[model samples]
Target chain A: MTRTSDRERRRDPARIALYVFLLASAAFFLLPVVVVVLNSLKTMDEIRQGSLLALPASPTFDFWRIAWSSACSGIECRGISPGLFNSIKIAVPAVFLSVLVGALNGYALSQWKRPAADRIMLAITFGLFVPYQCMMYPTIVLARTGGLFGTYPGIVLIHVVYGIPYTTLLFRNFYAGLPDELTKAARIEGASFLQTFGHVMLPLSVNMLVVVGVLQFTGIWNDYFLGFIFAGNENAPMTVQLNNLVNNTRGEVAINVNMAATILTALPTLLVYLLSGRYFVRGIAAGAVKG
Target chain B: MTRSKAPARGLSDMPESGFRPDLVAIGFFLVVALVFYGSLLWTGYLSLTNSRLIPSYEIVGFDQFARLVATPRWRTACVNLVILGAFGIAGSLALGTLLAILLDRDVRAEGLLRSIFLHPLALSLVITGLAWRWLLDPVTGIQSVLRGLGWSSFHLDWLADPDTAIYALVVASIWRSSGLVMIIMLAGLRGVDTDIWKAIRLEGIPLWRAYAQIVLPSLKLTIASCIILLMADVVRSYDLVIALTKGGPGFSTDLPAKFAVDHFFGRANIGLASAASVVILGFVASLLVPYLLIQRKGRA
Candidate 1:
C-alpha cells in the first residue's frame, strides 16, 4: 500500500505521456463526430463561414428536421424519412428471422454427434468469410428469376441468408459450451429434440439471444452495400438515402443537411451501442476470437 | 437401478426423436451449399464467359480474366486494396494495441475514453467516410480552419488528389476499426494471467521488453484474429470508397468490390464484373483457408 502510494505520488513522465497519447487518440476518434454534430446544428451560412471544428454559434434542430423530412435524397425530396421506416421494417424482421434460424441451426448442430455435422459447420463458418460481391451477381440473378428481386421480402431473405452464418456461429459456439448432461437429462425426461430445445435451451439462451440480436440489428441497420444493391430504390435503407442526399450533385450543396442526415442515419446503431454496449462488445469479441 | 436403466434407454431412444433435428440441420446445410457455394461456382463460370448485360453461355475460357488483368481501373483497384490492407491493418493494430495497453493500466475515465474510441465503430462506413470527407475537404474543412488560425500553409486536399485519395480511405477505415481492435485486445490483455506480470515484476524486466518478448507473443491467436477481421474489412471495402471518394478523380479510390459492382450494374459488363468478383473470392480464400487450417490444427 505504501509503495503504491509512493508510485502514485511520483510524476512519471512515461505515464503522463501515455495518458496524453490515449487522450489524443480519443480526441482524434471523436473529431469527425464532433465536426459532423456541430455542422449539423449550424446554419449553411455558418458552416460556410465558420471553421469546421468550431461550435455552432446558434445551434438549432432545423437541419435535423429538414434531413428527417424535407431534404432531397435523390430524385425525391422526401428526405430520409422513407428510408428510416424502410430500415426499421427491414431490420426488425431480418433480426428476428435470422436469430430464429440461427438458434435452430445452432442447437441442432451442437447436439448432433455425426462427423457430417462438423463438415457442415465448417462450411457454414467458411461462408462467414466469403465476400458478398462474389455472391451478389448470382443472388441477383436468382432473386430476379424467382420474381423476388426489388421487393421487401426479397431484402429480408437476403439479410437472413447472409446473417445465418454469423448468428449460427455465435449460437453454435454458445450451445457447444453447454454441458452435455443437459441434453442427456432432457432426453431422459422423454423430451423430443424440438421440445428439449424449446423447453431447455431457448430458456437458457436469453443472454446469447440478446447478444446475437443486438449484433444483427446494428449490422443490418448500418449496412450500406447490401442495402444499396438489394433494397432497390423504394426499400433503400437510411445509409443509402443519407449517401444519396450528401452526394447528390444537383442543386445547392447543403453541408448542414448532409451532416444532419449522417447523424440521423448513425443514430440507431449508436443508440444500440450506448444502450447495450456490453452485449455489443461481447458479440464482437466472440465473433473475432472465434472466427 | 431404474434411473440408470432409464438413462441407457434414453440414450438408445434418442435417435427416434433426433430425426427431425438432423433433417433440419441438413436442410440448412443444403441451403447454404446452394446459395453460398453455388454463387461462387456461378460467378467463376460467369467469369469465363463473354457475358455482357446478359448471361452468355458461350465460354471464352480465360479471356475475361485476361481482360480483367488488362483493365487499368481493375488494376488500380487491386493495387489500392493492397495499399489499404497493408497500411490499414498495421495502423489499426498498432494504434489499437497501444490504446488497449493504456486502458489496461487502470486509468481514470477508462470507460469514458473507451466509449469515445468505440463510438465510431457503431457508425456505418458511409457516415465515417462522409465525416472524414467533410473534415478533409480543403476549402471548407481542416485546411481552411487551420489557415484561419494563421497556419497559412495548411493544405490537406487528399480527397481530391488521385495519388493521395487511397490514404484518406486508409485513415478513415483505421479510425473506424481501431476501436474494435482495441476492445478485442483489451479483452485479451485482461485474460492474461496476473502471475506472468508478477514474475516479470519480480525479475525487474523492462515493461516494453516484457510486452515485446512475452505478452504479445502469447496473444498470437488474438493478433491473428484482429488481422483476419481487418483484412476482411479491407477486402470488401466498398461503402467507404463510394461515400468518401466515389472512386473519383478518375477511379483512384476504387476497390475491387466497387469495381465489380460498377462493371456489373453501371458499365453493364457482366463478364468483367464476374471476373473481378472471382478474383476477390480468390483473395479471400487465400487468406481464409490458411487461417481455417491453423484453427483446425489448434483445435486438434
Candidate 2:
C-alpha cells in the first residue's frame, strides 16, 4: 500500500478525536481526586479565594494537625482517634469470628458434602443477595431487644452475621480446589471430622486465611452504617467523625479540614491495602483460577 | 459453660462427645437456617402490616406496597438507578478495556500506572463519595473556587443539584469500580491467542480493526459477567450515595437500597421498608429465573 497522504490521515479525525475523548474521560475520572489533593495543600484563605487549580502561597500543615488531633466531630473537641480504636475493637473480633465461622462452614460443606449441602449453600447464597438495608431494621430490633443495642458486642455480632457470606463464598470455592485425598486418607485412618480438618486442612490454608482476614478487615473497618447505628456516641468508629467533619465542617465549610479528615479516615485501611495488595491480588487470582 | 468440656475435638469425633456428624451439629445448622429464614419471614409479615417504630400484630394487607408504588421517591429512585447503573457500567467497561489494551501493549511502567488506578480500590471506597463531596459541594468546592478566581461563570454543582446529583454518584462509583473492571477485562484480553493477531496483521488489518473484529468479540463472557456484577452492585449500592448526598437535594439521588435503608433505620417504618425490599428481591428473582430457565432449556 502507498503511504497515506496528509488528507487521508486528516480524514481519520474521528480516530484522533477518540484519543482526545479518552484523555478527557480519564481526566474526568481523576477530577475529584485531583481536586482533593489540590485543595489539601491550599491554605484556608487561598481555598476560599480561587479556583481549585490555583496553588497556595503558603500551604500550611495546620489543617492536617487539626484533623488528626483536634477537629470536633459532634460537640467534642477530640478528633477521630478514639473512633479509630473503636473500629479496631469492632473490626478485629468481628473479623476473627466471621472468618472462623465461614471457614468452618466452607470446609464442612465442600469436604464433607453433607446431605442438603447444596441447598443449604444456595439458601445462604440467596442470603447474600438480600438487601442489607432490609436486614438492618430487624438487626437493630434484635439488638435492642437483646439489650445489646449501641454496644460493642452488638456491633461485632452484626458484622459477623452480615459478613458470613463474603468470607464463606471465597473460602468455599477455594477449599473446593484443595486435594480431597488428604482428607480422605486422614479419615481412612479413623481420623474424625475435627482432627482431619484441623490437621489436614487448616495448615494448608495460610494464604487463604490472610486473604480472608484482609477482606473482612476492610469490610468491617470501612463500614459506616453499622458503626453509626450500633456504636452510639462513645463507640462510634472513625468514619463517624470523618462524616461529621465533612458534613458540618465547623461553622463555615473548611475544605482543607475535610481533605485532611478524609486522608486520616482512610489511612489505616489504605496502609493495609498497600501492604497487602500483592497478597490480595494473588489470593483472588488463585481463587478465580480454581473456580 | 458446662458444654465447654474438652471431651473430644479429635478427628475421630468420638460418639460420647458429639462428633461433627452428631445430631447436635445437625441441630446447629438447622438453628442457623431457621434464624436466617425466620427473620425474612417476619419481614414479609411486617410488610403486610402497619408496623412502624414497633412491630404491631395488625395486618394492613399490601397497603405498604401500594403506597410504595405510588410514592414519587420510589419512582425517582428506580429511574435514577437505571441511569446511574447504565452510565457506571458502560463507563467503567470502556475505561477498563482501554486501560487493559493500552497496558497490554508492552508499555513501560504498566504496573505503576495500573497500581495508581487500582489504588483507589485499596482504600475503603466510602471515601470516594466523601472525596467527591468535597470536590462538588457548592460552598467549599471547585465551583466556589472558580467563582472567586474571576471565572464567576463556572457552574458545576452536581452533588447539590436535585437533577444532577445522581450523575455525581455515577462519577464516584465509576471511579471506585473501574479498577476491578480493568482487572477482569485485562484477564480476558490476555487470554486471547496471539496467533490471531499475527494472522490479522498479515492480512493488512490494522491493530484497531483486529482488536475490534477479533479480540473484542471474544471478550463477550467477561463483558456479560461484568454487566451482571454491576447490576447487582447498583442494586446493592447504599454506602456511597448515603455518604455523598444522603438521597437528598430532596431525594433526587435516592436509590432503592437507600430508600429501604432510610425507612428501615431513620424513618422506622419497617412495614413500608420491607415491602420495598420484597419488591426489589422479586425483581432480582424474576431476572434470574428467565436466564436460568432459558439456559436450562437451551441445554436440554
Candidate 3:
C-alpha cells in the first residue's frame, strides 16, 4: 500500500472502476464453466429443479463416475473412455508428424530458399483457409482409394496435412528470425543440409517446438469435426462421443452426466492450457501474426 | 536482411549441379500440393457433375448450383451466415478492443486476469457449445435460474427458439473468440509508440479521443488481420454449431458449413454439398487473397 504515489491515490476511483469492469468480464467468461461444473456435481433431481447456477443440495461424484464408465450410447453402455483412448492415439501421432513435417518445410524455406518456394509456400498456406467441407468429399474419396478410410491412420493423415500450414508458418517465422551465420558457418565446414539442421537449427528451436507442441496438442485433441468424419465408430474421439451423449436428442436427457462428460472430455486440453499458459500465448501470437 | 545478404554472396549458394532442387523438400511440397490442388480440382469436378450418394463424373453443368439456390434451407443457411458473421466479427472486435484498452492501463494481477480471459481458446468448440447450450437452455439454465430468483418473466431461451438461435451462436462464439481478439489487440496496443502517449498526455487529450484518432489508425494492420482471421473462423465454423443448436428449431441457425455437412453426410447429396463447399471457398478466398498479399509485402 505504501508503494502507491499521491497521484495514483487521486486516480483510485478510475482504477477501482476499471477493476470492476475487468472482474465482471472475467466472471462472465468463467460463468459457463462454473455453471457446468456445479451442475455436473448435482444429482439428476437437483438439475431437474431447473436452477443450473444453484449450489447443489447434495454434491456427488456419481455422475462423473457414470460418465466415465457406464453412460449409455445406443445399445451398449460404454462410457467415453474408448473415445478418450482414441483421441490420444490420434493426437499423439498427428502432432508428432505434423510438427516434424512443418519443421522440415520451414527449414527448407528459410535455409534453402528456392526461387519458386515462396510462391509455393504462399499457396500451401492458403490451404489453411479452406473450409474442411470443401476438402471433405475428396479427402474421404482419397482415403477410401488408399484403403485408409475409417481408420486411425486416415484421421491422422488429415490432421497432419491440415496442421502443416500453420505450423510451417510458425516455424518459418521462427527460423527466419534466427541468424543465417550459423548455417553458413556449418556449410563452410563441409556440413550437409541434415547436419546443419540437426546440429545447429534444431538445437536452437527447442522453445518454438514446445510452443508448437502445445498448440498442436490442444488443437488435435479438441477437434471434433475431423474425428467425427474420418475416425469412424470404433476410433471416434472423445468429443464425438461427448456430442453423442449430450446431444443425442432421442435419449432421456441426463443433464448432469452430460455436464460431467463435457468436463471430462475437455480436461486434457484445459490442463495443457493451464500448465503451459505462457507458451500457449506465444503459439497463438506466432501462428496468427505470421500465418 | 543482413542474413540474406551474407548467404547470397557465399560459394555455398551456388548450385552443386545447375538448377538442382531439394528433392526431400520438394517431395514434401508435392505431397501437400497434391492434397490441396487435388481436393480443389476434385471438389470442383464433383460440383459440376450429377454426383449423388457416389461420384457420377458425367458433367451436369450447374444443376446442383441451381438446386442449391432454389432450396429454402440453403437460403436460410446463407442468411444465417451473414447475420452470424457480422455480429460475431463486430461483437468480438468491440469487446476485445475494450478489454485490451482496459488492460493497457496496467492493472494488478494482469497476468492472472489475462489467463482467465484466454483459457477458452484452449477448449474445443464442442465444449464451448455444450457449456453454452446448458447455460442458455430455458428449462435447465439461466432462464430457470432467473425464475427461481422470482423473476417470473425471464425468457433467455434463445437456444431453442428458431428466430433467436443464431444470436445464441453469435454470443457463444464471441465468448470463445473475444479472448483471442483481446490478446492480438493487446499486442497491437503494446506496439504503439511511447512518444505518442507522451504527446497525448502533454496535450491533455481524453483517453477515448487518443485511442480513437491516434491509437486505432496506427493499428490498422492489426485490426485488418484480426478481421480477416475472424472472417476465416466464420467460414470454417462447424464444431460449435454441431455441439450447440445442431442447426435446430427448424433449421433457422443453419450455417453453410453445417449445410454442406448435412448434405454430404446426412442427406447424401454429394453434388449439392460440393457446390456449397465451393461457394464457401469463394468467400474465404476473397478474404484471404488480400490478407496473404499484404502479409507477403509486410515480410518483404
Candidate 4:
C-alpha cells in the first residue's frame, strides 16, 4: 500500500508535467494566428514600428476595410474581395459536381466488380501522381483547341478533373465499409443502377460526403497555381487578389494593410473551418483510416 | 433496429438479372485518364526535343538536360529543395507533435485549439506569404519594431539577405505545414489503444517514457507520410515562392517549380522548362517509390 501511494505520487508529477508541456506547446501553435489577428487592427505606421505582441495604439479597423476594398493586386487596386467572390463561384459548383460524381464513381466501384473496374481505379491512382505542371501545357493546348481557354467553365473543369482522385478515394473507402446487403436488397427491389446509388449508397454516405466537401472546399478555394495559370486574369481567385496585393505594393511597405489582405484572402475557408471543424475532423479521420 | 429491418429488406441471393451499362462511369474514367495521362506523355516528349513555345519535331537528344544540369541556379534549386524538404518536414513534425500531445490532455475547448492549429492548412500560401512578408519586412516589420523599442543595432534582415532567404521561406512554410501534421498526429493519438495506457498504469511506466518508446515508435507510419507530404509541398512549392519573394533578393530562394514556371511561361523557354520538369519528376518519382514501398509494408 505504501508503494501504491508512492506510485501515485510519481504519477501526479507526470500528469502535471504533461499538462504543463502541452499547454505551453498549444500556446506556441496559437502564436501566428494571434499575430495575424492582432496585426489586422493596427495602421501601417503603427504596424511598421510596433511590437508584435502589443495591441494597436488606437485599435482601428482601417487596414481591414482597405485590405478588403482598395488594396492593389498587381496593377489593379480592387483588394482581395473580388478574388473571394471568384473562389465562392468556383468552389460551390466545383464541390457539388465533384462530390456528386465522386460519390457515384465510388459507389459503383465499391459495389461492382469487373475487369474494367480495376483498370478504371488504376488509371485514377496514376492520375494522382501525374503532377499538374506536366499536364498544364497540354490542358492549355486542349483547352485552346476545344475553344475553352480563358473561360469559367474551362477552369471549373480543371478543378473537377483534379478533384476526382481525392474525392473518389474518400467515397470509395466509405462505400466499402457500408453494408453490402443494403445494395443487394435495393437491387432485389428492382432498383436501377442510378436508383441504387441515389437511394441506397448515397444516403449512408453523409459522413464521407462531409469529408469530401470540406477537402474539396479547402482545395478548390485555396488553390493558387491552377487558378493563376488557368482562371485567367479576369476570373482570378482570392489568392490572385492576395497575390496582386502583395506583388504591387511599392516601397515604404503598408504592413497593416498587407496583413489584413492576407486575412481577407483566407477568410472563407477560415470561416468554414470555424463553423465546421467537427465535420472537417470527422472527414479527415474517415479519409485517413480508409485511405 | 437494423436487425428488425433486415428481414423486411427485399434483398435476394440471386444476382441482378441484367448487366449494368456502366458506360457513363467507364467513359468518365477513360476521358479523364486520357487527358491527364496524355498531357504527361506530351510533356515527356516535349522535354526530349529542341522545342520552344510549342511542340516541335527537332530532336535535341538531351541537350536541354545537359544545359539544365550545368546551370548553377538549377543546381542550387535542387539543393534548396532538399534542405527545405528536410527542415520543413522535420520542423513541422516536431511542432505538430508537440501541439497534438498538448491538445490530447483534455484541454478546455479542445475544438477551438484544434481549429487554430489547422487554420493554416486551409489557407493559400499567397495570403500566408503576404502576411509573413509583412511580419518579416526589415524596414517595416518586426525589425523596425524592435529597433523602435530601441535596439538600434539589431540586424534581422534575413528576407532581404541573399544568404538566408531560403531559410526564411522555410520558416513561413513551416507555419503553413505544421498544422496538418498536428491534425494527423492527433488522429494517430486517438488510435492508441486504451489497453496500452492500462498496461503503463499497471507497470507504473512514466508517461513520457511510454510516449517516447511506444507511442512515438507506433507513429512511424504517420511520421513517414507527413514527411513525404511536406517534402512534396516543398518540392512543388511555386506559388508560395512567387507570392513571398518572387525569386527575389537576387533569386536566392529560387525553386525548381518556380524555375519551371518561369522558363515555361515567363521566359518562353519550353524546352528548358520541360527538361527541368522531367528532372524534378524523376526525383519525385524516386522518392515516392520508396515511400510507397514503406506504405505497402505497413499495410501488411
Candidate 5:
C-alpha cells in the first residue's frame, strides 16, 4: 500500500500538468468566441475605450437590432433580415430535396446489384473532391440557359446538386449496413420501388435523415461563396449579407455591429450543434471516414 | 421485426415488375456526369482559348495557359497554396492528435472540453475568419487589449503585414480545423485495441513512445483520412480568405480558389480563370486519383 501510494504521489504532478494543459487548450478554443460575444454586447464607445477582454460596461441589444433590421449591407440600408429569410427559403428546400434524392439514390444503389451502381458510386465519390470552382463556370452557363440563375429555384438546385455527394454517401453507407432481409421482405410483399423506400427504408432512416439534414442545413445556411455567386443581390443569404455588412469600407466601420451580425449569422448552426451534438459528431465522423 | 415472416430472397433477385429504382440511380448518374464531368471537359477546353469578358472559344492554342503561368499573382497564389497546405495540414494534424491523446485519458468534463473544441467546426469558416480577424487586428483587438492591461510593448499586427499575413491565415485555419482533426483522431484512438494498451503497460513502455511507435503507425488510415480532408479544405479555401483578409495588403494572402474567382467575376478574364480552375482541378485529381487507387487496392 505504501509503495502504490508513493507511485501515485510521484504521478500527481504529471497529472496536474496534463489537466492544466487541457484547460489552457480549451481556453484557446473558446477565446475567440468569448471575445466576439463580449464585444457584441458592448457599445462602440466602450469597445474603443476598453480592452477586448474586459466585461462590457454597458451592455445593450442595439447592435443586434441594427445588424438584424437596419444596418447597411452594401448599398441597402436593410440589414440581414432579408438575407435571413432568403437563407431559410434556400436551405429548407435544398436540404429536403437533397436528402430525399440521396435517400432514393442510396437505397437503389445499396439494394440493387446492378452493374452500373459501382461506377455511379465512383463518379459520385469523384464529385466529392472536384473543387466547386472547376464546375462554377459551366454551372453558371447552364443555370443561365435554364433561366434558373439568380432565382430561388436556381440556388436551391445548385445546393442540391452540390450536396448530392455527401448526402448520398451518408445514406448509402447507412442502408448498406442493414440486414439484407429487410429489403428482401419488402420486395416479397410486392411493394413497388417507391413503396419500399417510403414504407420500409425511409422509415428506418429517421436518425440518419436527422443527421444528414442537420449537416446540410448548417452547410447551406453558412455558405457564402455559392450565395455570393448565385443568390444575386436581391436573394443573397445571411452569410453573404454579413460579409457585405462587415467588409463594406465606404462608411465608418461599426465594429460592434459587425460582431453582432457575425454572432447572429452563426446562431442557427450553433443552435443546431447545441441541440443535436451527438448526431452532428456522428455525421461528421461518418462523412469524414467514408469520404 | 417482421423480417422473419417473409421468405429470404437471393441477393440477385431484384424486383422486376415494380417502378425501376435503377432508373433513378441512372438519372442521378447522368446528372453527376453532366454537371461534374461535363464541367471538367468544358473548363479544360476553355483553358486553351483566349476568351476574355465572355468565353470566345476561339481555341488560341494554350494562350491562356501560357498567360496564366506568366501572371505574378498566379505564382504567388500557387506558392501560398503550398504554404497553406503544408503548414495547415501539419499543424492541425499535430494539434489534433495531441488533443485526442489528451482526451483519450479519463479526464473529467471530457464532454464539455470536447464540445468547446468542436464547436468551431459547426460555425461557418466565414464566422471563423471574422472572429479571428477581429481578435488579431492590432489597433482594436488583442494588441490594444493587452496594452490596456499595461503590457505596453505588446504587438500583433500580422493581419495587416503582408510578409507575415499568410501565417495569420495559417493560425486562424489551424484554430478552426484542428478541432475536427482532434475528433477524428480521438475516434481513431478509441478504436485502438485494448490489448495494445495492456501490452504496453506490461512492457513498461513510455506512453509517448508507445503512441509514436506502435499506436500511431497502426492508425495510418486515420491519419491519411485526416490529411486528405485537410488538403481538400486547403484547395477549396475561399470564404475564410475573403472574410479574414480579402487577399489584402496587396494580394499577399491570395490562394488559387480566390485567384480563380477574382479573375472570373472581378476581372472578367474567363479564359485565364478557367485555366486556373483547371489547374486547381488537376491538383485535386492528382491527390484524389492516387488515393482512390490505393483505397480500391486496399478494398480488393
Candidate 6:
C-alpha cells in the first residue's frame, strides 16, 4: 500500500495518463445509469428534441409515481406495486429458509464427520454448476405432480432448493475457518451434536448469517426466470414486472416511465450493493476460491 | 452446564434433552439431493422420450436428439451461444484487467471510481437490458442523439438488425459482468509480492515487462477462475436475452437457455427442451470439472 502512495508522489506522465484512462472508463461504465436517470426525469418532447446525453429541461418525479402506481403490464394496468409486494413476500421466506438451512448444513459438515460426507458435499457443489435450465423440465413436472406449479410456495421452494448449494458452500467455508479445537472441546465436555451446534456453532455464525442473508435476499429478489415460470402471473416478482413494463409493446412506449420502473425494480439490490458490497465480494470470493 | 462431568457419548447418538439439530442439516441435504439430482436424472430421461406438451413414459430413443440437431432455430441458438461466450469472456477479461491495473495505480477518488465500476454487478440483467435497449435504440437512442449533434450520417442499428442483435447481447453482458472481473483481478493484483516490485525497479525493468513476465504468471489461478465464471454466465444467460430481444428478429439472437425456456413454456416441446438443457449442462460441466480439480489440487 505504501508502495502505491510513494509512486503516486512522483509526478510522471504515465500516472497522468493512467488517471485520464480511469476517469474515461469510469464514465463509460456509468453511462447507462446516467442515461436512464437523466431521461427518466424529462418529458417525451424534451427527450425527442435532445440526445440521450442531454439534461432534462424540466425535471419531474411524475414518471416515478406513475411507474410505481399505474404503468401498464399486459392487460393489467396496475403497475409495479403488486409485483413489488410479491417479490418481498417471496424473498423474505426464501432467504430465511435457504440461509437457515445453509447454516445448519455448514455446522453439521464442520462438526460431524459422517461417512460419505465429502462425496455428498461434492455432489451438492456439483449441483451448483448444473444449469438451472437442465433442472427446469423435471422441476416443473414435480411441482405439477405435487400440485405446486405456479404457486407461491413452489417459487419459494425453487429458490430455497437452488440457493442451498451456494449458502451451504458459504457457511461451510466460514465454519471451516474456525479452530476445530472448539468443536473437539465441546464434544469432550459431553455436549451432544445438537448441543454443541446450538451453544457453540450457532452463536459463532452470527456474522455469517448477515453474509448469507444479503446474498440470498438480493438474488431471490432480483430473480426473474423462476418467478416468471413458476410463481404464476399473480405472484410474479418485480423483475418480471420490470421486464413486462420495458418489453411489453401493446401500449405506447413511455421511455420515462419505463426507465423509472427499471430503476425501481433494481433499487433493492443496488442498496445492498452500496451498503454491503465488500461482504458481497467476500461471499463470491469464498465460492470461487474454494471451488 | 453441570453435564460437563459426564463421559462423552457416541458422536451419532441422539440427544436426550433438547431438539435434534442434526436433523436440520441431514434433512435439508436429503431433500436437496432428491430434488436437485433427481431432477437432473429425470430431465435426462425425459429427453429420450417422445413427450410434447405433456411428458410421456414411452421412450423414443435419440429421435428427439436427432430433431434438435436438424432444427434450424436450435442450431442458430447454439451458434449464438458460442459467439456470446467467446466475445463476452474475452472482452470482459481484457477490459477488467485494464481497469484493475488503472485502479492499482493509486489514482484520485479511487473509492468512488471503484464503486462506479462495480455497481453494474449489483443490478439484475433485466434492468441492464432495459437500460441498454433504450440507449441502443435507433430512433430515440445514441444514433439519434449523434444525429441530433450534427452527425446526421451516423448509423447504429445493431439491436434491430438480425446480423448484429446477438452482438448487442454480448455488449450488455460484458458491461454487466466486467466489474466483477475487475474487482477479482484487483484483489489478485493486491496480493502480488512487494519484493518482486522492488526487485524489478532495482533492475530498472519496465513496469509493463515486469507485470507481463513475472506478475501475470503468478496470477494463473485468477485468470482461469475469471474465464470459468464468465463461461458459466454465458450458459445461464436467459434474463438478458429475454429482456433484450425475446429471441426475435427472426430468432437471430436465440440462445440455448432461452431456447429451452421458449420450448418448455411457449412452444410446448418438452422433449426437445429437455435435450437442449442437457446440452447446456454438459457444456457448463465440461468447464467446471477442471476448476474443481484445480481447487482440490490447491488444497492438497
Best by DockQ: 1
Model 6 chain B poorest 10 in a row by lDDT: B1-10
lDDT by residue for model 1 (B267-290), tens:
999999999999999889888866
Tens digit of per-residue lDDT, candidate 4, span B1-300: 012334323332455544252664676687677677777777778888988876786887998999899988888788878878878888888988877887886556777667766777777777677667766778666687778889999887888888787887888888877788888899889888888878877899987898899888988888777776677667788877887788878778888988888788988888888898888777667666756666576667
Candidate 5 residue lDDT tens string, A1-291 = 013455585578877888899999998899988999898899888888888889998789999999899999767888778988998999999999999988898888776565467778878988888888877998899999999999889999999999888888889888878887777677777888889899988989999999999999988998889999998888899999999999888787888899999999998899999999999999999888873
Instruction: Encode model 3's per-residue lDDT on B8-109: one tens digit a residue.
Output: 456556555322226556777787777877888889889998888988999989999999999999999999999988999999999999999999887779
Q: What is the TM-score of chain B in candidate 3?
A: 0.94
Residue pairs in candidate 6 whose N, alpha carbon or C atoms collide under 3 angstroms:
none
Q: Which parts of model 4 are misplaced by more than 4 Å? A: A1-24, A249-253, A286-290, B1-22, B106-108, B147-155
Docking quality (DockQ) for each candidate: 0.62, 0.34, 0.60, 0.41, 0.60, 0.53
User: By how many angstroms RMSD does model 1 differ from the true structure?
Assistant: 2.9
Q: Please give the distance, in angstroms, between residue B56's alpha carbon in candidate 2 and its true position after superposition.
A: 1.7
- What ranking of all candidate models by TM-score puts the best one first? 1, 3, 5, 6, 4, 2
- By lDDT, the best candidate is 1
Tens-place lDDT per residue, model 2, B29-51, is 56456546666677788899998
After superposition, candidate 6 runs with Cα above 4 Å error: A1-10, B1-25
lDDT of 4 by residue, A1-291 (tens): 123454575568765776677667566556666778897898766655567768977888888888888877666777778887888888899899999988988777665555567567756755565567756777788898987787788888889888787777777667767766787677777888788788777788787788789878988888889898888888888887777676675655566777787777777888887778888877655544434
Q: What lDDT tens digits, residue by residue, belong to model 1 across residues A1-291?
A: 114564773588877988889889988998998888988999989888889888899889999999999998667999888989999999999999999899999989887766788889989998988889778889988898998888889999999999888998999899988876888888877788888898999999999999999999988998998888888888999999989999888899999989888888998999999999889889988888773
| lDDT, model 5, position A91 | 94
lDDT of 3 by residue, A1-291 (tens): 124776876578887889899999999999989998998899888778647778988789999999999997665578888889999999999998888888877877776565676776787788778888878888888889999988988999989988878888788778878876787677767777777777888888988989999999999999999999999998999999999877666667888898999999989999999999999999998777864
Give the DockQ ranking, best first.
Answer: 1, 3, 5, 6, 4, 2
- Residue A100's C-alpha lDDT in candidate 4? 92
Native contacts matched by each model: 0.75, 0.31, 0.61, 0.40, 0.71, 0.63
Error of 5 at B217 (Å): 1.0
